[model samples]
Target: MDIAATVIAIEFRLPGPININTAPAERLQELPGIGPALAARIVAFREEHGPFDTIEDLTHVPGIGPRTLDAVRDLITVVDER
Candidate 1:
């Protein structure tokens, strides 16, 4: 008798860039290095201050620094819903 082995792989893609202006904490948490605390901060910051004018503005969030911003910059977008 002989046996064969098979390998499989799966890939996931976001429908599009996450809109930082509109994404909820749950959605924002999906970004790399953005955990619950940071995700909440992002939401709160936006609510307190207003939508981000630029992706770089995310750094203004308490926990989001240059490194964290860099990690998710390509995956995020800033749109003015207003």
Candidate 2:
């Protein structure tokens, strides 16, 4: 059925991509799993650390994980030079 097909399409499609390295807390919440607490933590970590080295490095921050990183991997990038 058309409805079933639509659901299938949605299920097969990938979630939105997020940029973790520089996204603001509000923006971070747009991702799949992040909430205000995590978003605030991310901002604080960014402020304290200056900038992130890599997407994987987000896990090293106070409140992130592999799943969280996976959600925003495409959208986040380290813009500044090390």
Candidate 3:
């Protein structure tokens, strides 16, 4: 007689938060829930408007809102050289 079994495991990790002000789109996408389009929008919005004064300011971007902001707040930051 013979038997077969399978096992699986899932894991989640927290990478150090990224700085929104200076991080490239690729790096920005690493934030939870952010994708290529959203990351590009963030960068474009920053370039066209200006560096975000606070995390809440991300609301100005087309896709981000209070909910989305809250979701990734801990995984994002800003450092204004201005």
Candidate 4:
């Protein structure tokens, strides 16, 4: 009798571009440079000021500078709640 081994592979994918307007800090942390603290700051900024008008507006968030924004720009998006 002979035994055979089988290997399984799994692939992971993001649902789509993260919606900055609605994504929570946990979700925001998925970005390349965003960590827990930065993610929370983003959420706080959004909550305090309102949803971002554009991806570029993320620069307004403390700790989120141009470099961080550039890293995540292609991966994030802003959606209109209204």
Candidate 5:
């Protein structure tokens, strides 16, 4: 067996209580159904529009819908402005 073939892939998990309005694309990718492109779109949408008021507001983002919202709802939150 080749030594290189023995390499193992490791998965890195992000710490939870992730703030969707403020998390970087990388961290956002850890959500249930979100990937790199969707994560970037979320950030772009947030920047172009504004912060999300409620988790359901995520459906306003182009690719996200009610299903995706339901999947990630528990994993994300909008940080309140104080």
Candidate 6:
């Protein structure tokens, strides 16, 4: 299934932790507990702080944590530009 399809189709499978380096707010919102505001916060954070080097960097954002990250780990992808 497509990413969106997969995300919404299954309740047990939470959305992935989006890659701060690449995903826009819309994509980031797909994750559980990340609404538009939080998603926007993530995008804005990226704009100010720059690319994320690791998933741990998500904690720098106000709403994320290890639990949230773990919830969505399977769905998120970090693309390496270099």
lDDT of 3: 0.83
Segments in model 1 whose C-alpha atoms lie over 4 Å from true places: 1-12, 80-82
Alpha-carbon local distance difference test for all models: 0.85, 0.74, 0.83, 0.84, 0.85, 0.76
Candidate 5 clashing pairs, residues 3+ apart or interchain: none
In candidate 3, what are the lDDT values of residues 1-82, reduced to their tens digit?
2232222221124345678988999998888779999999999999999899988899999999888899999878786433
Clash pairs, model 1 backbone? none
Which model is ahead, 5 or 6, in terms of TM-score?
5
Residue 43, model 4, lDDT: 91
* lDDT by residue for model 6 (1-82), tens: 8998876888556444456679888888888877899889888988999877777777888888888877766666656433
- Tell me how far the alpha carbon of residue 49 in candidate 4 is from the true structure, in angstroms, after superposition: 0.3
* Candidate 6 TM-score, true structure as reference: 0.67
Candidate 2: where are CA atoms >4 Å away?
A: 1-21, 80-82
**Model 5 residue-pair collision total:** 0
Assess candidate 1 and give its lDDT: 0.85
What is the TM-score of each predicted model, taking all chains together? 0.79, 0.63, 0.75, 0.79, 0.76, 0.67
Give the range where candidate 3 is weakest over 10 consecutive residues by summed lDDT.
Answer: 2-11
Candidate 3 runs further than 4 Å off:
1-15, 80-82
Q: What is the overall TM-score of model 4 with all chains considered together?
A: 0.79
Lowest lDDT 10-residue stretch of candidate 4: 2-11
Worst 10 residues of 2 by lDDT: 14-23
Model 6, runs deviating above 4 Å:
1-18, 80-82
lDDT, residue 29, candidate 4: 90
Residue 82 in model 6: lDDT: 36
